[model samples]
Target chain A: MTDGTPILHMKDVRFQWPGRASFSLEVPSFEAGRGEKVLLLGESGSGKSTLLSLICGTIAADAGDVTIDGTRLSDLSGGARDQFRAETIGVIFQQFNLLPFGSVVDNILLPLRFAPERRARVSDARAEAAALSLALGLPDVQTAKAATLSVGQQQRVAVARALIGRPPLIIADEPTSALDANSQAAFLDLLFDQVRAHDTTLLIVSHDARLGERFDRVVQMADIARTTERAA
Target chain B: MMLRLAFGSLRARALTVTMTVLAIALSVALFLGVEKVRTGAKASFADTISGTDLIVGARSGSVQLLLYSVFRIGNATNNVTWQSYQDIAARPEVDWIVPISLGDSHRQFRVMGTTPAFFDRYKYRRDRGLELGDGAIMNDLFDAVIGSDVAATLGYAVDDPIVVAHGLASFTEHKDQPFRISGILKKTGTPVDRTVIVSMEAIEAIHVDWQNGAQIPGQSTPVEVIRQMDLTPKAVTAALVGVESPLQTFALQRAINTYPEEPLLAVLPGVALQELWGIVGIAETALLGVSAMVVVTALLGLMATIFSSLNERRREMAIFRAMGARPRTIMALLVLEAVLTSAAGAILGVAFLYLGLMIAQPMIDSAYGLWLPIDAPSTREALVLLGVVAAGAIVSMVPALRAYRLSVADGMMVRT
Candidate 1:
């Protein structure tokens, strides 16, 4: 994964906390092509969140290599990891995450403030913000204080923020969980379509299988021992 | 950009910032008020004596002597014999001498008895020479030239007949022989403002019937009757003298101390003022210390307010961190936020201080007869406010550190 070969490649990756008696995650090898929409499906306690953390470089894996965009996640220093994660990936949490006090535009502009490289590439950030807001169907007043919006609107703003300045990868963790069924289908359509339009790969994690058909590929996480016993 | 966020957050938490600003403002007001009065008191003291190299009076402490003679703060000790004043004033080193006889007041303001030469040579400060506001200078035996405060308080203009009490102590009213107000002085913001100036002969003529400090029992001497007696003072409270050279002060003092007629003390006005300051310095220090503690309390209150609001700021901090803000960046955000708020509070405090002084100046000058000048913060006070700003910034870190810890946990979405 540390080598400059694949856009994303994982090899024999295992992660466990220091005090834990068991490994929380294990993957011998995994690869995803550029511009791929991959759904990482998991039930409760399947370590989907743990794997997401590993991918984002928020938590270093215990063993093996996990690389994104040909840069090994483990190779990044603490500060560099933060910079790289912001520059390379747009992460969406289950809950719409926004700085409560800041205006919607300021929250969107947050990533570039951390990674100056992203700021340098975007010449017209204000225009991009307007386009991005308009694309999210965010009305002028809805973007004033993010807390003032409905859950669905907030989720869209979060998605807009994730795609703002157009990073290479989008990682969403149950980003549409709080939406109504109709809103969820509409949101998923807009989200995936935007990801395709921007040419960014998306690794979305969700427990619900009903949303699986929307992705190009669906990945099911297995119980390590049960799968091993079945393989034997 | 971070400034915008901090300011926005502060606005969101408007109640906390406003309370902090108000607390700091009151502290500044209190500090400026105390300092103004102290400075004004010192200035008034400085203006009370001028051109007089030394003031000789009956043997006593320097401050008490200065009090009765110059500031009219208290009654003088036993008056120096007239012959003793004469002996000292006759010296070759003495350029001019103004004899002063005290122990009288009207409405608690001192009435001083001196010769015409007292007004002619009496200079409270060298640069601020005597100038009359209206009417001629003292010419008649019982003519009275009033100080600015006395004129304002009693509404006495020139040629107005005003009586003098018998003693320097409060509650005495002498209705027997009232001297006319012959002249009034310009406001000097000094103790002279509260004084009534009359000739030593007027003092002698007015008290002629009162032998050995007692009026003959039931014997009434009318005002017209007093001017008929010999107007020569037996004893004078003090004498103000200008020296040929300041270097001869100690020699002059020794000469006055060893006078053959009576035991006397000569105090250099400058050294006496220093001594008087030493006498009152402890009270001033206590006041300054109290004001300083108020400032410290206000700053701590500000820190405590910010600390309380930090819990609400955790999620905001996590959002910044998740946006690729580094650990130091988060810390910088809080630090910068603290500094700006503290600086803002301090600036508001100074503005509040200026406004308070402006409001209090007239009231203090008229009501308490104390001049509160509008001036820049003293160096010590400036340093205290700066310390408040610094302490405020440091105080902000307490909340920021809490945020930092939350952000660390928030790294893996583990933060609550």
Candidate 2:
């Protein structure tokens, strides 16, 4: 439990948009330990989404190392990188996270379709998804379409999807911004309970500072990424 | 797995997929139906008169001569005199002559005046000679031999008597000289199916009391009295000529055409049939072109449908990419959907064509006098169906490639 190697690490990582001279990102150093709940707080246009994309291996950092667990994302080929991302990370968006046409349990089991390792990690995927959804405080809606669920119910379904195969990391972009204060509190309680039980590292990015009290630490985008140097 | 996903997406959008498939089915049916009828008509028309070397009649258009003599569609401008018929019959190259006279009708069916020799020389559908299906050939002066269609339509049997009208649309009937049906010819699937055959003497006897196309009021001759008179034909409409050897056909036709005694026309039956096809080939090709265009338009509609849906499905593509689907998987899914849609349409179209043919068989035969054989799809038709599916697959690439590019470029980022 105390080996002291971080589960996520970024060292002097720099990313620049191709053909755009006015914007760039530079992070000197960032790390999240195993079983750490980290809140990344940034305003709407402060590159929170771009940071998450780089961390999830969807986009590459132009300069330095971006590592997840023990693997450097740049060292893997495109196909291997996609497979690694599927096997290691589960992503949830701000709203409308589930595929609207898929049934509730089918959406929950989608990650197993791509990553055979994830599929192998779970036995009886449907029963696992049902148990996950029940633990997340949702009724038995395994056969219902995701589009028919309420906003609170959809968020709970997204949480169940993110935790189905027990991936090592869960990256959620503004996961609680669409919920009310009581529902948000209740959702954080349910999410933290699952994260602790599975020893998963959680990184949720949002501008809502009220959510800062629930995480172990809060990291500000301004303190980590320097965006001053531009070609004006 | 990809195919199952494609079908699921299609099922989600059932209305659009249904309309597109129906459009494809209608066009495919029309395309194959037109081809079927075209081949049927061409075969029936070409099979009308076979084993006859030349058709001779009064000097007129070769097509006109062919129409009146073979198809019985129109009247000859002038009659071929019995003397010219005799002259041609005496040629050494000529093997036999079956002279025919036509100008009268009975119940909208043409009446032909010919001798007993016509039954042996006249052939249709590739050397098939006319055989009496029932009773015997004309024996008495007023005895008639009816075709299968005439007997079936008029409900006439071996002893039924029928009065002949003067012309096709005339009301002047030779009521006193009604002919009795002595024989019914077998079904030949030719113009002969609708003909009423009588002896040449009967034609001349019926007109003996008529002057200038009308029977004189008080000079009407009795049937018994007319039987005693000499009824040798003075003029005949046309004649079918057969050569002793195939090589002498052209020479015999040339000799008849250049005869110094009268102005007459002698045409090779095969050549006239080709000329007729040349005239009708234009309409046939135009019809074929129209049906082909309908197929193309339907395919374009399919392309448009898949293309427009791409915008709404962009978010869905992003979702799949997020789930680790490669770009090529997206492309294959779309192409598979298109292939399934068109393959189903092709099968349904074939079913529709056979069903339509079954319902329209009797009406088409009675209306056009052409028999269409209801048989399995020929090789050409099967190839056409395959071509339709291949075209559908090719047209689907427009949307599939677009979706591939989108999934690669806009990875995990849905704009809408």
**Model 2: runs farther than 4 Å from truth?**
A1-7, A11-31, A57-65, A69-84, A95-109, A120-166, A175-198, A207-214, A221-232, B59-63, B106-108, B116-122, B127-186, B205-226
Point to the candidate with the largest DockQ: 1
lDDT by residue (B124-173, candidate 1, tens digit) is 65567667888877788878888877888878877778877787564545
Work out the iRMS of candidate 2.
1.7
Worst 10 residues of 1 chain A by lDDT: A223-232
Candidate 1 structure quality by residue, lDDT tens digits, A1-232: 1123555778888876444555457777777778888888788567776777778886777789989888998888978888998898887878748876778887777787777777877787777777777877778743487777778877777888888777888888898888889999988988977888888888888898889888878888763211111111
On TM-score, the leading prediction is 1
Cα lDDT tens digits for candidate 2, B333-393: 7888888888878888888889988988776876667888889999999999999999989
Number of backbone collisions per candidate, in order? 3, 0
Candidate 2, residue A75: how far the Cα is off, in Å: 5.0
Off by over 4 Å in 1: A1-32, A41-50, A141-143, A219-232, B32-44, B168-170, B211-215, B366-387, B412-414
